[model samples]
Target: MTFSSSYLFSLTTFIYMGAAALYLIHWIFRVKKVGFLATVVTVGGIVIQTVGIGLRWIESYQLGYGHAPLSNLYESLVFFSWVTIVVYLIIEWQVKQRVIGAFATPFASLSMAYASFSPNIEDKIQPLIPALKSNWLIAHVVTCFLGYASFAVACGLGIMYLIKNRFSGASEGIMGVIPDCKILDELIHQTIVFGFLWLTLGIITGAIWANDAWGTYWSWDPKETWSLITWFVYATALHARFVRGWAGRRIAYISIIGFASVMFTYFGVNFLLSGLHSYGAQ
Candidate 1:
């Protein structure tokens, strides 16, 4: 890693950690000033991370790799963390809610932390392999991570929902800042819909990339199979909502379940099973 990118990324970790503290404190105490500071720091950290990613891309070129930073596990984790914040910031702006950050930003921080610290992971930026050297790499990885980020947000909100629901009627102080069940349900549904679409696009892009690399459109690789299973799980959730009017807690549970499938598709397949995309394994 270049000096600039490495330093910036390290700074991003602490900035997010502090932001998480500020956000959680604000949510608990309703401190306007602290929440404002949290917002500033979160946005600032995101900007810094963006610069870090850009620097990494430049560094890749300097090393003659000449590829986007989305070429490996470390880069993808960083990208995923970045996208999660981007998605959360947008939702916080649109809904004008800050408390969700209490549940959201820690995931971003931990993703960075893990990428930085995990002994099992490799952070070096090597040249793209033959299979990954295509326009489809960017499209496939970006779209998929967007979907993953959205689902991550949905998972966080699902936890918030259950908490808010558990003490909603009886204990106002514990879950006071949490929005009502209706709003939480709607937000979860909206995120799921957004994620499902992006996952669909990611799958399509992956198919295109696969055919380009391997001369086949749909081989049932383990990762591919798990992704398809995830797609079906969300599809079933959506269908239940549209046709059977499933909503509220059921939908929230489904969102959590779908994210489990997503995690498996992302980390589990790469770690436990060998496949065509074995390069992803640490």
Candidate 2:
């Protein structure tokens, strides 16, 4: 079979699935070896997916589009998967915890699965809309999705936090694999801070792109509005952490809510609302 981008992405989806399972097994049955294998599988999957993305970019130029492979919903979803794993691996490296993969890899897997299987999403490389022809396209999309991917990992950490927090008393069995609640809390804050900076940059770059494309920096389009809302969500969480000394479940809840806003801004605004950015859905 031809090694098309779609085929590689499909393979990546299953690789992530297997990685997630290995992580779960590691967490549940205390299979230390499986945790290492899971990390290895995830690393291999991302390498293959990276090659696929580069191949797609080459294919685009070959087809005369001559643009980055980040032009539509399918491409964005694939990049989202890529960036999420990148961020997760970083966290794993820093914190020395592989159990988070059980929660994190699923997000990447689901994204790849959705991109590969969703009938509504087209995987073809199409011409850029005139508005998207700006050089800012790469900067804006990369920053925004980096922020999105970071939040995706943060959301997974939040879920892990909640699980460990809820089962504080049952710390002997499967729950033992998760880090301490305090560790998870601190990681949640650090992840959000990292993502917030990127999101802030994303919004700034987006506003500049808007000015170039639409003669205004802020149009309050549905996508733009929701992006601001998502920014504020993380901002509020950070503010609470810094000024109010909040932590634990409150921060975890906010992380989950913030990611919800991210999703709505990404998928909901594209599909549900008509706006200048509606071409994103295409």
Candidate 3:
């Protein structure tokens, strides 16, 4: 990548960190201006990140190899964080709530920062390996990360729900900044539903890709297994909420557990286990 492009990526990381801090402070102090500033900084970071991705693509072509940045763990993680922030911003705009952004922004920023700065992670735009040289690569990776991002948002809402539920009868000032427990629970459920739909599509597309590349629809790879485990957790949450008439604290706790599985699917599988998706490790 060009020096300028790397610089832009660095700047984007810093901006996101600032935005995340602003969001957290807003939640703690209930400052409207801090939330507004967080939104502004986040948008700025996204714009810079877009430019960085574009520059990396051009750099790949200049190196006589043309491929999307998604070919590597670092690039994929950066893109994952970018998509997470974008989706969180959209949800915040629609819901007119900033509390979730408090948690989401920090996590997103930290992930991006890790990708950008970690020496163990490779940031070069290398040619795609033969195993990954397929059209389905983009679809599979993008869809899965989108689902992961949505779940990350849901996880943030779930955390908020727990906090609000715990302080429902308390007179804490910070607790007052959170929404009602019922509203928090509803928001968590809605975000999880959104995540579940995307995750289903991601897994289906990945299955098709595996079939095309390896002539098998399922191999129970570590990544695939963890993803299935995550799906089951969320599915159980849905069943509990709808069939068992569970809501509020129980549902919030389930979402927390489900999102923990989501984290394992995204990070734990790569770092702690062996798999075909080891390219996702960083």
Winning candidate number (lDDT): 2
TM-score of each: 0.96, 0.97, 0.95
Residue by residue across 135-155, what tens digits does model 2's lDDT show? 999999999998998999899
For 1-282, candidate 3 gives per-residue lDDT tens digits of: 346667888888899999989988988998899989989888999999998888888888888888777888888778888889988999889988887788788778888888888899888777887888889888988888888888888888888888777778865688887878877877878888888888998899999999999998799999899999999988887788766558777878888888789888888899999988887774
Ranking by TM-score: 2, 1, 3
Best by TM-score: 2
> For candidate 1, lDDT tens digit of each residue in 1-282?
346787888898889889999999999998889889999999999999999999989988998989998988888889999999999999999998899999889889988898888888888779887878899899999999999999999989988998888787855564877888899989998999999999999999999989988898899999999999999988887877776557788888888899899999989999898898788885
The number of residue pairs in model 3 that clash at the backbone is 0
Off by over 4 Å in 1: 243-245
Task: Give stretches of model 2 more than 4 Å off.
Answer: 243-245
Worst 10 residues of 2 by lDDT: 239-248
Clashing pairs in 2: none
Better of 1 and 3 by TM-score: 1
User: Between which residue pairs do clashes occur in model 3?
Assistant: none
Question: What lDDT does the true structure give each of the candidates?
Answer: 0.90, 0.91, 0.84
Task: Please tell me which model should have the higher TM-score, number 1 or number 2.
Answer: 2
Worst 10 residues of 1 by lDDT: 168-177
